[model samples]
Target: MPTVSDFVIRRIREWGVSRVFGFPGDGIGEFDGALGKAQRDEDGLDYVRPTHEEICALMATAHAKFTGEVGVCIATSSPGGFHMLNGLYDAKMDNQPVVAIVGQQGLNALGTSNQQASHLERTFSDVAVYVQTVLSPEQAQAVVDTAFRTARIKLGPAVIILPHDVQGMEFSPLTPENWVSRSSAVAPSTAICPPEDDIKRAASIINAGKKVTFLVGHGANGATDEVLEAAKKAGAGIITALRGKQVVPADVPFHSQQLGLLGSLPSYNQMKDCDTLVMLGTNYPYGQFLPKSGQARAIQVDLKPEQMGLRYPTELNLWGDVKTTLDALIPHLEAKTDLAWQDKVANEMVEWENEMEAQATLTFDDGVNPRRVFFELNKRLPATAIVTADAGTTADWYGHHIRLQRGMLGDLSGRLATMLAAMPYATSAKFAHSERPVICTIGDGAFQMLGMNELITVKKYMKQWQNPQLIIVVLHNNDLEQVSWEMRTEDANPVWSTSQDVESIDYAGWAELLGFTGIRVRTDDEVPAAWDRAFATQGVTLIDAYTSRNVPPLPPHITLEFAENTGEALLKHDPHTVEVIKDTAKAVVTEGVERVKGKLHIGDDDKRES
Candidate 1:
């Protein structure tokens, strides 16, 4: 008779799980033994040990993000299982396919206040799409099968709570009918498409507008060429949600970069002024940035029917595969000839590009500008580089300054906005597509959050790297700069303890000790040279850069209240730099207005009704 743990591990492999990331602990020895047996047999899943269980879960989520396959991770009972929640929530929010197998204390220990005791099924319920506890060997096979299927089909985290004693019990072998199947029952297809009449109505709305714009998201991944074709036929200017940043080529004539706070001025202009907005496969949450009621007639296309018009009021909603729906709608659209809207969007795009270049090159005489780091990295980025940015000030630079070229992949936090995900995401990207160079940008505060221990995971797998250029660029500003700025702008408070006056950590020394080539950069001129050295290194490298904490991540659309609060906070803390802050704010606003004034007819009517 086979042990329940052996059956579970074999079932996981049958479901095409090649690797499992986890941290080893007590009460899970039987499961570990099963994994060990699989490895020895040369037909089982490979076990990857990370320094922490949270990092393990994050690596699994990122694996699914990059590979479009279900990611697998495991953890021991109680505290170890609880540590996996943050990463599992990231997967849940980002809609990635991940399955976490948590070892609970012995079945006999239930409700007895035993050591490492936990009600894991209840604890994992909210974070998982499907949660189940295997109470006996009779239920192990069905429970494990359901966990894998639910993860891939629902595109979120699923959990299997395995008890220590249950996993050790002898079990009967599974028959052929109990084996895993490759095909999914819940994937997108034409059968899930909306009614023909709804698609026709959407096409009519699009055809009626003279100035239409397309807002796309990650759901349009496989429909790039079709989307471009539809945009050209409809004469629509294109803008993307952050997740869809690289889904369409940014260099296209009608493309206007991303929208919302971490976006470009041209994108804001297009979304606000268009007569019709064609939303494709994106549930962009910033309703304030989108066109208000009666401003633009909206049409939405999405695979999920419930999400079709939840973000914005829709005149017509088409629910289907983006590629298939676009194929049907294009034939019904009238070929557009008006270049007025296109020219207006194009002019703003040029100005935005020029403004970005100016901002990226602006450096203080004293400290390194973090924007310049992104500029230099963009210049050195390979066409196939996979870039990931942690949530913080570094994300601001990565989102705005970095230009993802063709064949490049940009990994963001999406809805989670969690810190310390960048390095793990990049590490998984390296393993999933080892031929591509992987770069992760993280702030010093974010680096210390959960990323410090994960460097060992990178070093552990460095021998298998195909690119030999796994670079982790640390923006060593020694402050929680983003949170500090938010405290001032959002709450009208001083920087407070967020910007602690602590001594800098020796990040470069730590990296060097972990078998990585570490380079510390304090000057702007060393930025590009440091990147050159990192790419030339044989394995993992960390470029720890000391940047200024005073430079703020300026918003594309500045409000009077924000400016006022920021100025007041500056006066309270650093009175000497008030004028500098004012100048920076004014320069960005003035440049943006001048760029789009000609197209928007800003001064054509001096009839000031107010």
Candidate 2:
């Protein structure tokens, strides 16, 4: 008879899992041995071992995001399971389907306070939708099936705690005499359309408003055409949440990129001015950026009923798949001939783009402006590229500068877990789509935390990819830039240099030591060339971009509070006060100049026409 571990592996394979991310330990030795045997077969699961258990979980989350498949990760019990919490939370918060299989101390060791014998089910309760342990070999298949099914249906993580001794036991098939249950590997359909009455009510509100805005999120991924069509019919301006960036093409005339601190000015203006608001698929967390509570008549459509009206007071809530709901609602919407609102939004977006370009080109006294690095990378990004960014100024530039084309895919830790997911996400994206180029943008603080170790994992599997283009862009600023800025803007506090400053490392040298191409960029002029060279390289390349810590990532709409707090912080005599003030002034002045230039150009066009 086969071992229970072998049966569990076979069950996961039957569920269509082609790859599994994991790390080996004695707690999971049986499963590891079974995996080794499985690897010898002609059609077997590809096992990817990242540097740590945390990375395994992060990679699993990325796999789900990129491939739209159920991501599976395995780890030893106790300490290994503890390390996976952060990454599992990443999946949970982002609403990705991931299954974590963790090993435990033997059943005989229970209640003895033995090694690695903690209550895993209780530990994983908050992070996972479902958590269970296989008490017997006969129950193994049912447990595995339920975990995968629950993960898929809940759109979150599921945990399976396998005891060490249970894995080596002989597998038993389900039968009438054994009191065992059988489960299927088939996945259920998720597409749902809202009721006709709800659809009509949503349509009526959208139709009656003179100025309308659509807030699109990740739920709108596959319904791009429907969203565009509905927007055209409703004559609405489109604003995407950060997670919904790829749902609609950035170049759409009526679309104003993203909305929030890392968002565009046009998006802010559209939200503030629109009389009607329709939110789709996204539960955007920033309530301050949204229209005031009674200012606009709101309608929200989401797959989860609980998510409906959670962000704003909606006149109507439709719980349905975004694409199906939109398809059903679109026919009821009367076509609007007045597209003046869309035209105004498009024009503001043009101005916003001009301001961003001006900001990107500004020179800094200390080092290369980080915006310039991302600005240059955006120009060179291929349509087939998959990009991942860490939480920091990297996310700032990525949100404001990078305009992902229709076919391209990009994501980060949506809930913004700093220094935890970027490199692992990129590694997993490369593994999932070996034919596409992958780019990871990370700050020095985050890169040093875990990214360096993941490079070894990259090197070990570099030859397995058909397309060997994985570019890691390191913004080598010797400070925790985002935290520093947040203190200034949110707390009116000066930079606490002792805690904020990061130890400098020769990042490019380390990459070169690992036998990968490494390029160092110091000046503004070198930014474009460094990106060019990284893209041109046939294998993994790391661009160590020495960037300024002083460049402020200005919010789209700067309020009195932000201005006052920044001024107070500056008055407190921060170490980089002079540089910060200078950089901030330059960015502000550049935007003013760009706005004036745009007006003058328009005036000139009017004069010629007259």
Candidate 3:
């Protein structure tokens, strides 16, 4: 009879999981044996070793995000499993399909408080959609199947806890049908279209409003064309949540930028101006950005019925996939010939672009500004590049400035809101799509937190990468800029411990020591050349640029609270408080003026030309 480990590994491979990310340990010797034989025979799953189990979990999460396949990661007993929690939460929060297999202490050691023992099931309960421990060899197959199936179907993490003793136990005979299956563990799931009456009701609601805006999300991933069709018919402008940024091209005539605090003025303007908000495939949680209840009629479409109207009160809640709903609802919509609303919003976007360009050009004499650095990177980035951003001011800059082309794939921690994921996410993207350039943007503080160590993992696997252009852009501000900005701008508190005064490490030097082409830039003149050098280099490269920490991440719209907080924080903290606030306030006021002019028909192009 085959060992339980043999059956577990075999079933994982059978479930269409070609690779597993994790580290080997003494407690998982039986599983390691099975993995070793599988690798030797080239008939089992490929095991990828990362420097840390958290990195392994992050890599698995990213793999699932990119491929829509069930990503798997393995860990040893106790501490190893504990390390996976952060990454597992990243997957769970992002709603990516991932399965974590953790080795538990021997079953005989139960209640003995053995070394490396913890309640694995209890530990994973909150993060996993399915969590169970295999008590015996006979239970291995069912546990593995349920974990994979649940992960894929639920689009979240599942955990399987295997004790050391159970792993070594004799199992039932391994038949082909018992271990291997042709279908994907999650396949045979059908697309759910909304009922005809509900679709018609949604169409009716959308048609009734003269000015409408369509908010798209990640659920609209593959239905871009249909979304555009619906938008055209309904005569609506399009705005996307951060995850749905790629659903519609930013350069399109009616497509506005993202919404919320990190969003653009045009998106906010469109949302406020629209009479009806037709939300598709997204339960974007920022209700403040959305029209309040009774402020606008709403039509929400989601594959999961429970998500419908959870964020906003919907007049018509259509339960369906994005593409199917759009296809069914299109014929019912009245094509609006008077596209004045969309055209006006489009003109505002052009003005916003002009403002962005002007802001990107402003910089201090000490170092290159973060905006210009990102602007230059955006210019040089390949159209087919895969971009990942760490959670910080770096992501805020990227969100505002970087406009991804149709072929590009860009992502940040949308809901996880965590740091140290960018490097692993970019690495996974590079590994999955080796022909595309992979770029990870991170702040200096976040880079020091976890990204610096993960560079070694990139170096180790650099030879296997076909693209040869794995680039890491470090915004070296030497502080936790986002946190500090929030404390000052949101809470009106003087920045105290939020700011870091650590001696700056030569990030590029570290990259060079790790067998990567490293370049550090401080001037505007050196910016483009550094990016060019990184892109042209034959292996992994790091471009570290010292950016200004004082440059405020100005919101598209400055409310009274934001303005007051900025003034209060500056007066209380910095010596040059007035000058700092005045300088930043100039840009904010100018953008605000343009929005007013657009609303009042003062400076619009058509009005001016007339």
Candidate 4:
């Protein structure tokens, strides 16, 4: 006679909970007992122990996202579970499949104001796709099963809490007797196609409009090519949400590379003028960017209905698989659209191309811009290699600089854009994709945010398998360059950077502590040899370069517009560095304004040409 904890463990496994993240504590006492018991009873139910709760959930989220499987994360009581909420939010926003388990106080103690028994459902309501609290052991299976179905089928984050007392009680089975042998849950109909009328209306509206635009989001990930097909057929321009950027390549003429925050101007302006906005698979967050008056009819297509009208006004909401929805809509559309509108939009996209080239061209003089870094990295690395980056400036740099020439390979991190996930996530991605070389890039400040202890994981994997997938390059600037720039240029106090000091940790020494091969490059002259040694390492290797902190990135277009001052900004150096600060002063005072005056513009006469 086993307890509900036994069934819970079984259910977790059946849901393909291959990995569990978070700490063990008293709140999950019965859970701990059940896990220990399962180890004795079952042959291979090994639980993974992560150093931090946040790392654990992040690991689980990455594993699930990369493998297209249910990522399971577990935490005990309120505190540990709360630590996982950020990663849970990332999973939800990224549309990754995630199932969370939190330990609760016993049922009787729940209402007694027990120490660890808290209102977790209310806490997670807004962040998760689905959430439930089970009162009985009998209900645990159903609750877990439903959560699993929601996570796998909806491909969204879901949560379930098991009270300690329920874990110790046995009940009738909710799943089939041979649960482990069941097939995996497929994406539910709700995630793909919602209703019939909305679908027809969405199609009809697109059929009527002369100029159609497709706005993609995370929800529309799997159907990128199909959406492209519909765009090409309708002679429509494609615009992507921040989440959808990686789904569609920036190089495509029809694709709108204009995303929010640090995104470009073309897609944003194009959005303002379109006659029809065809939402393909995305639940874009910034409704403000969408037309305010419904002048541009919005034809929404997604797997989830709840997501529709969440951000903007929707004239036609079609619920179906993005791939299927496009197929359904294309038949109703004319075989070809009037190229007059499409070509006008295409010509506007030429601005994006000129901007891209301006952004990509790097001078030997400019020390390091994220865009330039990505440009250089692209040439050195193979096309199909994997990349993992922390949030913050690294995310911004990558978002602006890196072009997603491949498939659904994208990002992670909560909306706050917090940093320091690359190393840990790279460990998971490297293990998952052993055949692919995994690149983890982190800013100096970001590398210091997480436990330096986890570098051991990379060492362990390399020692055991002689794996070459892990390649971590720390963007070693002395301070948080992005924040420092924001403070100086944008007039905001620089957010506190996590960097230890101007001359921080002996990064090479830290790498050696964990059995990783480490190299430090003191000058730009050492770049080639340092990179060579890194590739020759037997285990996880770290390349720590001393970079110029004041070298602000000057994109071609931006630099061209502010030519004189651009050169001045590029020359500005951190006081401690050996860069040419005097040269910047001369350029700024002499003719910076005149250089800016020479630039070109059209449409508006407010000032310098755009």
TM-scores for every predicted model: 0.92, 0.97, 0.93, 0.80
Query: What TM-score quantifies how close candidate 2 is to the native fold?
Result: 0.97
Error of 2 at 228 (Å): 1.3
**Residue by residue across 272-306, what tens digits does model 2's lDDT show?**
77899999988898899999899899999887677
The whole-model lDDT of each prediction reads 0.81, 0.90, 0.81, 0.65
- Encode model 1's per-residue lDDT on 445-478: one tens digit a residue: 7788778888977878877877767889998877
Residue 609 CA displacement from its true place in model 2, Å: 36
TM-score of 4: 0.80
Clashing pairs in 3: none
For model 2, the run of ten residues with the poorest summed lDDT? 600-609
Off by over 4 Å in 3: 173-186, 497-499, 574-586, 589-610
Better model by lDDT, 2 or 3? 2
The residue ranges of model 1 lying beyond 4 angstroms of the native Cα positions read 173-191, 498-503, 574-610
- Number of colliding residue pairs in each model: 0, 0, 0, 12
Instruction: Provide the RMSD of all predictions against the true structure, rounded to 1 decimal.
Output: 3.4, 3.7, 3.9, 5.7
Q: Model 4: how far is 204 from its true place, Å? A: 3.9
Off by over 4 Å in 2: 177-179, 599-610
Which structure is stronger by lDDT: 1 or 4? 1
Q: Say which candidate scores most in TM-score.
A: 2
For candidate 3, the lDDT comes to: 0.81
Candidate with the greatest lDDT versus the true structure: 2
